[model samples]
Target: MDASIFSAPKIDCHCHIFDPESFPYAPGVFYAPSGGEIATADYFMQVMSAYGVSHALLVGPNSGYGTDNRCMLDAIRRGGHRFKGIAVVENDASASQLQDLQAQGVVGIAFNMALLGLAHYANADALWERIAALDMCVQVQVQDDQMAELAPRLLGCGAQIVVDHHGRPDISRGLASPGFDALLRMADSGRCAVKLSGYDKFSREALPFADAQPFTDVLLSAFGPANCLWGSDWPNIRATRRLDYGTLLGVFERSVPSEADRRTILVDTPMRLFGFGTGGN
Candidate 1:
C-alpha cells in the first residue's frame, strides 16, 4: 500500500493509553491486556509516528480502567500538542471535577455502552449539561441495536454526539439494522458525527476488510466527509490475532478511496470537533 496517503498530518479520533503500574486496572475490569504490550503513552506515540499520525484522541479505556481517566489524562499531558483525551466520568460527577478534567487536556467524555450499558448513565442529563458548558463532546461506544434509543436521548442533552466504531453496525444484517438507520438519521440532522474506525471489529471478512465497504460507503454518504472522522483504534484489543497499524491505515485508504474525503476524515473533521488547533478551553 502506498504510504503517501498518510504523509499529511492526521488525527486519530479513538485510541487508548494504559499503565497498570501507575493507573492499575480496575478490579473486576472487563478485559485486562496481558503481557504489558502496547500499554503506555510512549509505545502508542511510536506507533502513531510510524503511521504519520500527528494528533490523537486518547480515549479512556473503560473495560480496562473503568471510570479512572488518570492514565488517559497523563498521556495527553505528556503528549503535548499531539494528544487530547476523552475521559470516562461517573454520571453524578460534579462540575468541579469535570473542570479539572478539562484543564487536564480532556476534550470529551466517553460512554462505553457496549460494555457498561445504559444504566451507567443514570445522571446523564446533568452530566451532559456540565460537559456541554465546557464545550466538550460526548463520545459513545454502543451496540448496533442501541442507537435508535440512545441517539435521541443524547441529542436531548444538547452536546455534540460522536458515535464510535462505524456505529458498530451488524453487517451480517446489512443496513436493515435499526440502529444503523437511526445513526444515519442522526448524521443527517448535522447533530452527530461518526468515527470511521474499528472496521476490524465489525468486519466479517479477513484482512483488507472489503466486507465492511458497503457500511463505510453508507456512513460517508450519510455523515458526509465533514462529519466523519477516522481513527486507528490503536492496539485493537479485540482482534483475534495481531493486526498491523499500517494495514489498518491501508484499509481506510481503500475504503474511502478519495483523497479529498480522506483529508476531511483524517484531519479536518476531528480538528474541528476536538478543537485541537483552535487552542480550545
Candidate 2:
C-alpha cells in the first residue's frame, strides 16, 4: 500500500470514539457500538499523527452516548485547535445549549437516521432551523430507499447538508434506484454532499471491497470531485475481520484512480468543508 497517502496536515472529516461503559447507550436506540477496546482522544491523536492527519471532524457515534459529547469535546480541547467536532444532541436542544456546543468546537450536528431509522427525525425541518440558525451543517444518514421521501425535506431546510455512506444507496438496483438518482440530482443542484465510506456495510461481497466500486464511481461522476469526501469508517463494526485504515485508503486508491479526484475526496473537499487553514490555518 502507499504510505505516502498519509502525508501531513490531512483532514479526516468523519470518525467516532467513545467509552461504551461510561457512556451507557439507551434502550430503543437503534444502533449499538460493535465492541472493541475503547478508543480515546489520545488514541485518536496517535492514529491521526501516524496517518499524518493534522485535523479531524469528530462525528458523534450513535452508540447510546446521546447528547453527552464530553469525551469527544475533551479530545478537541486537548487537540489544541487541530480539531473540530460535530455534536450529537437531542433534536430539541435549547438555543443556549446549541450556542454552548458551538463554543465547545462543534461545527455541525448529525442525525444517524439510516442506522436509527428515519421516523426518529420526523420533525427534521424544525430541527434544521435550530442548527441552521447556528450556521452549522446538518449531517443525515439516509439509505437509498429513503432518498425520495427525505431529500425534499432536506432541501426545504435550505441549509448545507451532508449525506453519509454514498447516500446509503442500493447498488444492486444500479442506476435505476430512485433514491440514488434523487441524491445525484441533489448533488447536481449543489445543495448537498456525500461521503464515500462504510462500504463494508453496504457491499455484498467481502475483501478488496470490489462490490463497493460501482457506487463509488457513480458518486464520483454525480457529486464530481468538489462535493465528494472520503472516510475510512474506521474501526468498522459490521466486519467479521479486522480491517485496517491503511487498507481502506488502499481500497480508495483502486476505486477512484484519478489523482486529482483522490485529492479532492481525501484532501481538498474536507479542507474546505471543515474550514482548514484558518489562523488555526
lDDT top scorer: 1
Q: Candidate 2 deviates by what RMSD?
A: 2.6
lDDT of 2 at 174: 78
113, model 2: CA deviation in Å?
1.6
| Candidate 2: regions farther than 4 A off | 1-3, 20-37, 238-240, 278-281
Task: Tell me the whole-model lDDT of each prediction, alpha carbons only.
Answer: 0.82, 0.76
Q: What is the C-alpha lDDT profile of model 1 across 1-281, one tens digit per residue? A: 43466686677888888788788889998788756344699888888878778888888886678888878888877886788988988888888998898888888898888777777676688888787778888888887788878888888888888989998888888987898888888976676899988877777888887878888999899889999998777777767656777888778888888888888888889878987773322
- In model 2, which residue pairs have backbone atoms overlapping below 3 Å? 277-281, 278-281
- In candidate 2, position 115 carries an lDDT of 69
Question: lDDT, candidate 1, residue 129?
Answer: 77
TM-score of 2: 0.90
Work out the TM-score per prediction.
Answer: 0.94, 0.90
* Candidate 2: tens digits of C-alpha lDDT, residues 3-117: 3565623567778776565555656655566456466677777887787776778887776466678867877888878788888888778768889988988888898777667
- Note the clash tally of each candidate: 0, 2
